[model samples]
Target: MDLLNNLALGFGVAFTFQNLMYALIGCLFGTLVGVLPGLGPLATIAMLLPITYGLPPVAALIMLAGIYYGAQYGGSTTAILVNLPGESSSVVTVIDGYQMARKGRAGPALAAAGMGSFFAGCVGTLILAAFAAPLTELALEFGPAEYFSLMIVGLIGAVVLASGSLLKALAMIVLGLLLGLVGTDVNSGVARYSFDIPELTDGISFVAIAMGIFGYGEIISNLSQSDENREVFTDKVKGIMPTATDLKRMFPAVLRGTALGSALGILPGGGALLSAFAAYTIEKKTKLKPGEVPFGQGNIRGVAAPEAANNAGAQTSFIPLLTLGIPPNAVMALMVGAMTIHNIQPGPQVMTSNPELFWGLIASMWIGNAMLIILNLPLIGIWIKLLTVPYKWLFPAIVLFCAIGVYSTNNNSFDIWVVALFGLIGYGFIKLGCEPAPLLLGLILGPMMEEYLRRALLISRGDWSVFVTRPISAGLLVVAAILLTIVLLPSVKKKREEAFVED
Candidate 1:
């Protein structure tokens, strides 16, 4: 009954005229960018973070959440139509989706992707609604030591789950922790690494870091690619509906993908990209029905499964951010920045203190999913038309918006320079084969970890054994250690590399 009441309250908040309008706008813009190659939700959200300052918190979060999952819906369109993945999570969709397009079954392929994504998105949101309150209750029991230990688990999970070299991920995390320390100390009010620069005193604007590393960095990289690499299929799309036979084949795949994605999405560093890959791999291993298409050669299941998984993953990845004040991925890290901007501290307290924002954001997701399905199918022609815009024109606009967004955060010009510096550094990270997601996670978690560690020690009078003395903290540390050990095993490392080989 309480759950029903909370949901009713959520709907009341979400159905407001202003909130509904922003949700529509977010879904529309998310699809537009998703249709265009190179631009992704991460960069787009980073660019828009500052703009959320003027919005009511619930409305702002609703819109941002819409953009994140809506991108999943739009990305499959490009993967099927252009043989290009508009979002990294859509990479697997290109294999069978483009083949379906090539075989003139593009309509069925697209319909499957859309239907799968919509179903999975709804299921994921349902899981979030059911589990979020319980998780918040669990989190409320945590003290400083337990919280610190939980962060350790979260960081280690990121390293274990992150693709590529373990050492590189660790190095990036350390670098981010160091960067996060540049601001004044909260306890002492003494500057640590400011070097007397007025701007450095407040530390680096995470908005600047996010925009530079994701927004500007991606634009700069996209600009370097030659025009020949960006060929679009321009073929006209006709039927948008899947046949009854196609629906039968798609239903099971969508179910499996949604389950896998919902579970994986809760793990740190396991987001839409991993969920899609895992779902595709599972579909490949499943035996095909008599007379059905093979794994990669225009298999409708291939399109349906990954699309469902990505969307599901995108929605469920919010679990940690909302429940524990921990961001599970780069995109969630940006969300942390957004929440902080609005003076809302994410975690258990949010549910107790700001039920409207919390439940309203959850309820708006269902509305957003419905909006995406409506927008994606009928507006396919419009999205395809948007693909025709040249990158040459798009890149400058993106760079300009990024600069403006960063500057507006503090109304300071120094942030523009900060963004430029990190833009180069971001490009350098790209060149160096280092992933920046872990770095962003570390930056976001560093200060919180420090505060927790200090509080724990202060409470124990500098006793180093406090973390292990508490049952909850001890369990968390043990989990982190076990995860690190398992990831370090040679056999698991080999398989891990193979899983992310698509990158």
Candidate 2:
């Protein structure tokens, strides 16, 4: 009954005329960015941060949220149509989706992606609505010790879930933690690592960092690659709706993907990228049905599962950000920046103090999902056309936008230099087999973790045992320990590596 009332209140707020329009606009923009390779929601949202300043907080958040899940919807289109993943989560979709398109089953494959996304998105939102309150209650019970323990679990989870070398991921986290230590010390009223630069006093501009690492970094990398072998499906799409047999094969895969994605999204550092990869890997491990196409061929289950998981994971990634004031990924970190700009602190109090913003955002996701399904199905051709635009033309405009966007944040030229510096660093990461996602997670969590650690020690008269003395904190640490133990086991480590191994 309380849940119903909260949802009703949320709907009442989200259904407002202004919010709906912004949601639509956001969804449209999200699809545009997602349809084009080398663009992503993180960079788009960072570039658009200035625009959100003037709007009502609820409207701004609704639109940003729309951009996120809407990207999930559009990403599959490019993957199926061109064998290019418009978003990282869609990388798995290209394996089978492009094959289906090659076989002239593009329309049915796209339909499966759309339907799977819609269903999983709805389920993921429902899970968020049902579990958010309970999670908030649990978060409310946490002390500084528990939070510190939880962050450990989160960092370790990132290492465990991240692809490529565990050593690289851990090194990135440490680097991020070091980077986060820049700026004025919270308690000491002194600068820690500012090196006497004024702009460094506030630490790094997250906008510059995000735009550099994800936006400019990506552009540089894409420019370095040869576009000679790129393929675009110009063949006519036969049918926009799935056949009866196709639907039967897809339903169970969607369900399983939704379940896996929803669960993973709530974990630390888990998001669409991890969920899609996991879902696709799981589907391949399942018994091959009689007469079913092989996993890398034109299997409809391959199309459905990762698409569902991607959407589901995208929706549920909000849990940690909203309830615990932790960002599970880079996009959520930008959201934290957005909320800070609006003077709205994210955490347990948000539900009680700002019910409309919290619930309205939730309500807007459902509406946005519906809008995406309606928009994607009919406008498939338009998105397909977008793939033909040459990178040379597109990348310069993106770089310009990123430069202008970074400058607008603080009206500082130094920030532009920051973006350039990090662009090179980001490209270096790409060359070094390192993942930046975990680094972003660590950077966002580092300051908060330090604060909590200090507060916990202060409360315990500098006794380190306080973390292990509290039952909840101890249990969280135990869980982190167990996760570390399992990941370190030789058999489990090999399987973990193999699960993420790219063919």
Measured against the true structure, the TM-scores of the candidates, in listed sequence, are 0.96, 0.97
Candidates' RMSD to native: 1.6, 1.5
- Return the clash pairs for model 2, or none: none
What's each prediction's clash count?
Answer: 0, 0
What would you estimate as the lDDT of candidate 1? 0.86
- Model 1 lDDT per residue over 279-394, tens place: 99999889989989887789999999999998888889989889988898888998998899899998999999999999999999999999988878888777777777888887
Query: Could you tell me the lDDT of residue 378 within candidate 1?
Result: 83
Off by over 4 Å in 1: none
Candidate 2 CA-lDDT value: 0.86
Cα RMSD, model 1: 1.6
- Report model 2's TM-score to 2 decimal places: 0.97
Tens-place lDDT per residue, model 2, 1-503, is 99999999999999999999999998998888767666667767766676677799999999988888666677788788877676677788989999999998999999999999999999999999998999999989999999899889989988888888889988988988888999999998898789999989999887788778877777787778788756778666767898898898899999999998998877776557788898998899999889889989899999999989988887788999899888877788889989988999889989989999999999998999999899888988787777788878888777887788788878899999999999999899878878887888888889989999999999999999999999999999999999999999999989888877657
